[model samples]
Target chain A: MHRMMSDKRTIFLMMAPGFAVFFAIVFIPVFVSLFYSFTDWDGISAYRMVGLHNYRELLLHDPVFWKALRNAFLLGGAFLLIQHPLAVATAMILQYCGRAEKALRTILFIPSIISGFVTSKMWVQILSTQFGLLNRLLDAVGLSTWRQDWLGSSSWAIASIIFVAMWQGFGYAFLLYYTGVKGIPQDLHEAARLDGATAWQLNTRIVLPLLQPVIRTSIILAFIAAFKQMDTVYLMTQGGPDNSTQFLATYLYQKAFSINLYGYANAISVLFIIVCLLVTAALNRMGRQEVGEF
Target chain B: MARANPAMNRKSPLGWPFGIVMAAFAAIQLFPLLWLVDYSLLKSSQFFGASILIWPKPAQWANYRIAFTAGHIPRYLTNSLVVAAVTIFLTVLLSMMTAYVLTRMKWRLSSFFYTLLVVGLIIPLHATLLPNFFIFKQFHLLDSYGALILPYVAFGLPFCTLIFCGFLQTVPRALEEAAVLDGLSVPGILVRIMLPITRPAIATVSVFSFLSSWNEFIMALTYVRSELYKTLPFSLLQFTGQYSSNYAAQAAVMTVIAIPSVVVYLLFTDQITSSISHGSVKG
Candidate 1:
């Protein structure tokens, strides 16, 4: 009892600021967004209660919401399938590389460290229709017909953007997998070789299984990144060409700030949170099986 | 798994070709950056020089001169510098306080506080978009450094606190207990005993907070409207104009904006790289 009194006071003092800032800024915003989702506020006008009306419209009436959600899913799916594998492959190759390893790692990591704005601008120049490098290169290679306005065309815009994102992000995911792969003992690989396993066989039966945790972590992170991505998207397309590349983050901004429909944006945010939660939970369930040991 | 004979030791089949392929990939990866340097160094006349090798004939070191010719960049760089400095100071302070208290205190609610910090991880920026707009407006802090700086500290505190808390967990408690027994006071123990032991964590937190605040764009875009109050990203975004559509100058602005993050990233790659690669995800 004597010890408890002083301990309680000190602990309270310690935990106060963290909880205070977080509860006020983060948690409060979450709940307020929920509350605002039911209103008819245009962000600057007097509010009116339209309980469940925004949600109703969003669930049944809105196509863009679904489209944005699907875009996020496409982004997430690409990260998991393409980016994650390439990150793993890059990291694995670098890890197996004997000399000049640090140089290679540093070189690979430069793109990740630069501002996304710079990379997006670079890609816009590269993928643009008239004077793009890709088109120029294609013309030089006698494959000029293969050239297209990657960012201008609606069909290819989202995919091209995803490709740029993956290209820039491959280093990060590669670093993650590289770190995890480096953690696995060299003895295990040698033992597998002693057991007469070929290179491909060892990778399939050993390295991949051991890397399940890393892979899951990579997928979850990549998915979350895909969902909240704004910087590159902001600069690259600005959710443009008739909202073809619009996402939840950008859409929320469009509704609340650009279009002045704060209440509806709040609804989108509420739903956005729910969808992210569901996706994360679903992934956790899928990744729940044991990451096997050597 | 067969440790192939080291490439240097054997002239294996396709060794040179494989080496060439990997080198080509590296070249492809670095080509755009090289192009960035190339463009930044070119005159408007020679800027679009046809040959990649022969381009940038006379390197215009003056592009850097033209970039800072009285605009938001200087102000933006200063604002970002102040914001980053203030953010690191306040966040590291708050993290130390929160981490120490949570670790040392004997309250039922300390665990809850720790959990709240964790949830801060999953709180997406979009979730807070509308509410914070209302918030800063009510506070009358729109387009001010206060508005930008305060939210940044709030966002960053959780991340640094997480690391500090984790670091605190690994620290032996006897030193803290000794300080307490010596009646040095709660604050004194943190300053005197805890801080010394947690130097690496603080260094990690400082580097991270500075880089993140310096690089962050979404909040700055949402909250900061006035060009006067804009940070580096904001400045770079609005650098391009309707008249000239100055791509070369914009590249210069991009270089200016890229400097602090790139320099800091390279300087503290060991810390930032390890921390980020540790997979403790935050915005």
Candidate 2:
């Protein structure tokens, strides 16, 4: 058994195919992107090496890059501050609900499963000015003054995009927290109850502490997702209303495809990876102090 | 079962409020889908009506017909299925083999390869877009199904491998040892013994691969230029462009495109949800 398991030939055969594909498609392209970031290649003509010129411009000159970076951070902050707490609370509420838990859980996760294109288009229609459901509903409720062009006006565009993104993403967050909440041993709850702890105290003191790891994981995932936000922004707004909703990925895509600034886009891609890694590393370091060892 | 908490077993005083809150959230989550189906049946003129939801006195099923024929739904749907099916098969097979080698086999560089593959989980897809485009163009793979399938399979490998490694860790090694005692070779044991045991993981990997490749838009948009190989989601973009004023038909297109994902999710909700928590927590 040892001989067969350790056969170098067998290991080589098993590992080679996946490694080849990963290297060619994913791994090598990252380096190639890094290489192209230095050259002023426009996808067709010969180019000269710029040597950190694109990076300098991106950092010091590009207003859109700054705005995109800020927007990405804003989205990440919203996820951590707004979406997560609400998700945890909802997961706790569902924990005690006897029979309706599964149905509600299923319903909540429907949005996450559907395509982003569908959700973005649906939200666009709902947020439309003239025939939009939101405006009609607001008027029906006698709050006609409340309605605005949700995606048209620059003021509301980013907020609308955030709201749509939150709606689309809330289900997965809820599920993660739900899994964490369910993993808490019922005995812990029982013990807390016996100790004369109120329900609120049971949640705040016991459940929240135990959910630290899950909270950390969710936050990191949210940050990575925020940096990776492209499809919805592209489909919904296309960084419109004077680029109010430009995300890093969408901007890189526009620079590459639309403007044909392949070199600059590659630079953006490199920076994109750096931002994701930095944020992930920082969060992981912060979470290194172990909590909830039970 | 009897020892289950009394508060959980019966309706606590807070149950009503909690249920209402959960129900409202579910409604919020589900309303857009319902509104979508509602509007897909209405005429284009009725879209601008006063009511938010105007029940079609007579449903306009022609919207679906137009979308199916004019939007090239069948062709795009077939292309998407081909891409998704091939991607899922290759991703599952390759990742399973990689996971087996990483977990079961002894090697000098096992941990090295493990870290190398797992680091891919955090590499954003945007980093590879331009370089991959140039690579495919050089290889003459642009505008072909291979353009999409290769990348999808590559991206799917890291996550699927992580899930498989996690599952394979929990399986008792005695199964493999016993199989070895039966004169089975390593590949034989992996095929007959390990494959069947990893059915749950396979289900998880398949669902995830299907979701990503099926709804994939950006890569498909960039890689495949021809209409023959365009996927389902791309058809929505084209339909919206071609018939910009036809709101109902566009809604119909979206509804049709969303059906497969919805069905897959409903079918594998347990596997999908469990694998998400397992993969994220461990990874």
Candidate 3:
């Protein structure tokens, strides 16, 4: 027993595989990215240290970087202002939905379950300038004047992207809020009802207050998701119509793979890491505030 | 408006509004997918001319055949399956082992290592992109299964480990004590006693990692350049790019790529919801 207790080798053996793989794939590469960010390593070239030159250029000179950041913030705001509230309300309504709850939840979540590629391509077709479903529906409803290029035009591009992103994410948010709502003790609602609490009052005061933790979680996740937004935008428009819908991920990919600007891309990546970590830390700090007395 | 009524009537008046909202959202949710399926069976001309609400008169089943044969969807499907299966196996095993150590063992660096693992969760994959590309290129692993599987396993480790660690902590210490009395080693105890009990956590992690890897795009797109090695998402993206004008074939490819994931979701809907909510709340 003593020998077994003292055996460090087994513990090391157990930790070795996961740590090695994680280090090689995730950890070491990030530091390598940091190092490369300070150099001019363009795929094939033997490069010398540029030492923050890439960072300076990306921060000071790049209009597209600011555009991407702005779009990401817009999407994040939509998640908070539009998606989360809608998800919570739907989840609340779903509780009262009785028999159709499971089916409705499943239907709402289906978009989330499908691949981004399929969703983006399908939306592209549905947003076709001439024969899109949105346009055709408008025509059918005698609102043909509203029909326009949804994904093609610069004006509607970001909103269209946000709508698709929100659609894809709606299910997960609903499920999260639904699960949170379900976790609330039933007797509280019963007691509230017995005390003459109205439905709106019950939800706002009792259920929603109890769901603050879940809401915080959903907000943080939605923000990070918006920040990391790439796949749908890449497939749908490739940040097109003059980079109108550019995102950090897509822009980084374009800079690296498309144009062979590995050093410049790495610099963008360093900022990307900083932004993600700061957002996460900030949210965590904010969530550390007063715990509800309930 | 009295809240003192029986539960049925108290909720009954608002039922219509809730039902209407749910039905409307469900319709909105389903419209794009239904349109995709509808458009997958039509020629481009037919697709452009047909009413958006209407189905094709004569469905073009050949699109499926063409997508499968000419578009190399079967190849992509097989590649996705292989990569996802292997990645799931490795991720679950590695996560279980790591979690077992972190929770059950008395290692000095456990917290530090655990923090390290958690950092993987927050590090944007885009940040890792160029370095991974360079490393893989150096190792001559580009356009290969290794490139995909390694990154998949690595990125998947954090969340899976978190889930497994949460589950492992709940396992009664008495079981391990009994195993120790019977001369079982730590690994043996993990294999014999812990693995069986952690089945649900394993299932959750497997489902999540599998789905993510199957639907993964950026890594597959950046690392793999060969048509022979592309996964479903990458293949679909490439096929759509090549045939941007052929809406039917693009839709067909999308449908073929989408079925596996949707079927997986249907099969594991309970696991997905339960596991994710469990992680979020506990996390």
Candidate 4:
């Protein structure tokens, strides 16, 4: 018994630094953020407790916040409605593409392997107004009138950002679906074929149903990514052109660093945390219930 | 073994369309990178005068030299290396220890601690940004490597630990028991038994943690103030701002920033994919 107790103590000691650092860096600060949200403390100021004022303003009065939230939703919707289907189709195609599968898979995953900063910068260069390839291509095709300042124009900015994000993230979705498709037993497909199912029926009935869990995981991953998106958005536009391209993360950052509204930023972050937790819980719950049904 | 259908073994008649589509998407994926490299060799005059689609005629590789000197890429590169290396080492060590305890130790709160660590994965990184910045300021650690290293390790731990835990669970219990019976200490078993068995897991975690620390931007931007302390990504951003009109120099700087990551990814492509797939499949 004494030996067991000593071992337990050792285990605790072993875990101390990891947990300490985790708490100091992540846990304590998250709570501190929650506490700061209720006050009007700039980073330097001796602030008053402005009790829910920040949240009130953010939730009810802030149009930019609404815009950020809407853009996030739109980005998430695009991932689901656009990127997911395309990834699934590509995965299925690659599965049937015989010798080209390995080469094509690697090609598709190129964007994902590069850093977000590099990819974002590359897109920024591609979208540059004066000497960008995109505009040059448009001009070459005699569609120069169709070219607008992609990153600068308000109407085009959000869409441009979305396109860049989708491009970068497409590889991840493709790989996931590819792995899922590869995992489906060959016998199942063979059995379905012997039952005289067409290729379309084989996909719809056997393959896709098995791929639902992967689809779910990808959607959740993409949604969280959209919600927490800051790097590409910050690098590309910094929520610019009259805040038309604002996102939750970038807005919080601008509030804290650019505008020095630390308290308001903290409020936004707390709300951000709550939204993330709720989304995660809701999605996992849905997964659980679906598994139960299965 | 079940045989795949003979028809399935052959390329489809529609393979051309599929191949063409995939190739087009591949081109889109790779075009910007190609452009970045192509333009990096152009002189300033050529950059301004030439069509964006045109290749460099007289390749002025001196642009890279100017980028290195003017952008101070070597210093930023060193800083990034130090930060990434330290964070990878520390995160892997700590995560292994935590995973060891969670998996092998007979603690009552093992599951609780496991949940605590795993929950870290879902917490939005931005939520911790301001508070950590404030805390670093309080500690007077701002503008130093510690500021970035601390958060990098902290944020990295959850994912690394989870990966280690998943891998550790598959390790046979008998090996650990045998090591203990041989009068090996807990640390001894971790070093001698656990470490070797979990090498692939370590590699996966190391690659990911290294990549995250190396490629991370927002934290580096928030924490570092001095040019001396700035990482490669932050330096590149600054370089762009400073040389916005010098597209060739900017492209050269970007290429310098990009090459290391691209090289690492190419070298560890299989490991990276396996690790990602492993995480998703297990989840």
Candidate number of the best TM-score: 2
Which candidate number has the best lDDT? 2
- Deviation in Å, model 2, residue A149 alpha carbon: 2.2
In order, what DockQ does each candidate have?
A: 0.42, 0.67, 0.54, 0.54
Candidates sorted by TM-score, best first: 2, 3, 4, 1
Displacement of residue A136 (Cα, Å) in model 4 is 1.3
Show where candidate 3 strays beyond 4 Å: A1-6, B1-11, B237-244
Residues A1-294 of candidate 1: C-alpha lDDT, one tens digit per residue: 227335766766666775677677777888989998989999667999999999999889988888888888898899988878877776666544445555676677778877787778878877878766677778778898999988877778898878888888877887777667666777787688779886567677888888888788778878888887777777788787788888888888888888899899999999888887777778778777875565
> What digit string (tens of lDDT, one per residue) describes model 2 on residues A128-217?
887799998999999999999999998799998888888899988999998888778888888998899988999999999999888888
Error of 4 at B69 (Å): 0.8
For residue A90, what is the lDDT in candidate 4? Answer: 89
Of candidate 2 chain A, the 10-residue stretch with the lowest lDDT total is: A285-294
lDDT of 2 at A153: 90
Error of 3 at A131 (Å): 2.3
Off by more than 4 A, model 1: A1-6, A189-202, A292-294, B1-20, B45-49, B52-55, B240-243, B280-283
- Give every collision pair in model 1: none
RMSD of each: 3.4, 1.8, 3.0, 2.7
Judged by DockQ, which candidate is best? 2
Taking the candidates one at a time, how many backbone clashes does each contain? 0, 0, 0, 0
lDDT of 4: 0.84
Candidate 4's C-alpha runs over 4 A off are A1-6, A196-198, A289-294, B1-17, B48-52, B240-242
lDDT of 1 at B256: 75
